[model samples]
Target: MRGLSWQIGLRYSMDRSGNQLVSFLSRLSMLGLILGVALLVVVLSVMNGFDQEMRSRILSLVPHITFQPWQQDRGDWQTLKAEVEQHPSVTAAAPFLQGNVMLIKGNAVEPSLLLGIDAAAERKVSRVGDFVDLGLLEGNREGLVLGDALAKKLGVEVGENISLGIPQSSDSNDVRFAKLPVLATVATGTELDQQLLLSSLETAARLLPSGQTLSLRVSIDDVFNAPRVAWELASVHGQDYIIRDWSQQFGNMYHAIQMSRKLVVIMLLAVVAVAIFNVVSTLVMVVNDKSADIAILRSQGASQGDILRIFLVYGAVIAGVGALAGGVLGVLLALGIGDIVAAIENALDMKLLQSDVYPINYLPSALRWGDIASVCGTAYVMSLVATLYPAWRASRMPPAEALRHG
Candidate 1:
């Protein structure tokens, strides 16, 4: 009986060779399902890729947590660092000093951030030296390394003297100046690249009284737990210590990415829902067109259950073909998205994202089988639901009434 029902369902689905609207609607149903699933796969993978780039490329430059003394007196940084490193979440810790200084070249001058770091220790927490133009991060003691943007603005390069204007005393309004040779430049590809200058702690100490201010910057195993880890740092360091995390500076951007992901998913789900429900109209029309065939079958000893099974088989086959094609195509698109985006960018002669403004210079994509499974499951379920009402209607038709009415 099931084999007979399948034969009839397959024939009905394929018998739309003459009618234009039936053929058109059938094609439209498949097209909608294909496009909907493909879109979800491509878009969500891009979002996941962006989230990954933000964490690995951008966050690698900043400390996840910082421990500073509220009072100006410096704590025993070596001991404190040792203690902080014991935490399972903590990856590396380094001491740093930050000060505002002005860089003056031959004719241009700019305000810059003087970041004092211990090269050996800083290497553990930051990727500053990894992406330099020349072999610049050799850390010539008492020398300076400027960010690419900062160096360009000042019209200086390696082996140039840039005068640093530093305040002489906190007691009075005296300003002292020191001439430092630019050693190397770094490009972080971030806004931080505009005004950042890396100097050894020796240089910063020589320029400014060092013992008064030094902070411990720590990196963590997980970016999301930075704030909680920071709180733990504070609690362990006692009330006199102050704590800050990268989330305090970059949390809003991370939050915006997450919110956009959710919003995009919700909006696309609506689109897929519309496409899936379009199956209802197509199936209903099929039922109407085949009512006579259904009557003939009923009169020939086929039960209502048989009639119902026939249409159900028809609907399932339609959904399965559409979904299978969509799933395959979507995964293919997701896998090739990076190359696809690059081609589009080259053809348009414009970039989708600017590295300095956005976290990455290009769109990224990662296809996870789990996400594909979720999309396929949802599409299949929606298509099945859409088939139910029309299938049920076809089963309830009275054979004599349908034949007489026709």
Candidate 2:
């Protein structure tokens, strides 16, 4: 009987001799589901890619944790660095001098975060060496490395001298000026490109007052664990230092990404649900059109349960085929969306993402099987549930009335 029900259901599903409108609606429902699922997959994959870029590009260069003196007594930076390196979560540690300064070239002036670093030790703590020309800073205390965007804004180039306006004291209006030749430029494809100035520790010390203490910057294996590790390190030193973590600096951006991802999922899932529920309308039309056939089957000893099962099977076949096909199409699109967008950008001769505004100016994608499974499963289940009402209506129809109406 089960086999017989399957055969009948499949035959009805495949039959195109019936009303043309019914067949068209069925196909349209399938098409909508395919489009909705494919779009969801692609968008989520792109969001995942952005998350990856944020972690890799921004977090890699920004210190995961930093420690600066809160008291007047400057502690031994080498001892602190060595102690930080001994932590299990800590990967590398380096000493740095950070201060804000204004860059002046001719008539152009721009504000920048001046970071003084040891070229050799900085490489161990961050990927700054990969983006910076380390050779230019080596043994060149009077040289400076500007972020590409800052350099462009100042109309300065490599080998051009730029004046640094450093504040003499935090409380006073006094400003000390010094000139240094631009050694190189760093292009990090992030906002850092607009505001960073790199120089050797000796050069930065010369620009500032005599008694500024060096701070420790530490990188860890797990970025998310930075806050906990930072506090633990602070506790060991009896709270004499100020502890800062990456989250305090960039937490808002990370939260924004997560919030955007959740909103996108909710909106896209609603679209998919609407597409799947269109099957309800399609099945209702099928039930009305097949009343005469349904009456004949009932008169031939087909039980109400059998009638219900037939329509359920029919709906299942439609939902199953549509969901499977959509899943396959979505997976394919998600895997290649990056290249597709890149090709489109090239052909159009325009940028979708600007380096000055956005982090990493390119579309990226990272397909996850978990997301694929969730989307397809939700679609299929919604589609299957949508068939219940029409199937029940078909089962409850009286054979005598149906035949009389036929």
In terms of lDDT, the best-performing candidate is 2
Report the C-alpha lDDT of model 2 over 211-308, residue by residue, as the tens digit: 87998888999998988998888789646678889999888888888899999989998998888778888999899889998899999988888889
- Model 2's lDDT to the true fold? 0.86
User: On residues 80-148, what C-alpha lDDT tens digit does candidate 1 reach at each position?
Assistant: 889899999998999988777878898888887788888888878977667763234335466888878
- Residue 369 of candidate 2: its Cα lDDT? 87
Q: How close is candidate 1 to the true structure, as a TM-score?
A: 0.87
Per-model TM-score, in order, reads 0.87, 0.92
Worst window of 10 by summed lDDT in candidate 2: 132-141
In candidate 2 the C-alpha lDDT for residue 20 amounts to 99
Candidate 1 collision pairs: none
- Model 1: lDDT of residue 184: 82
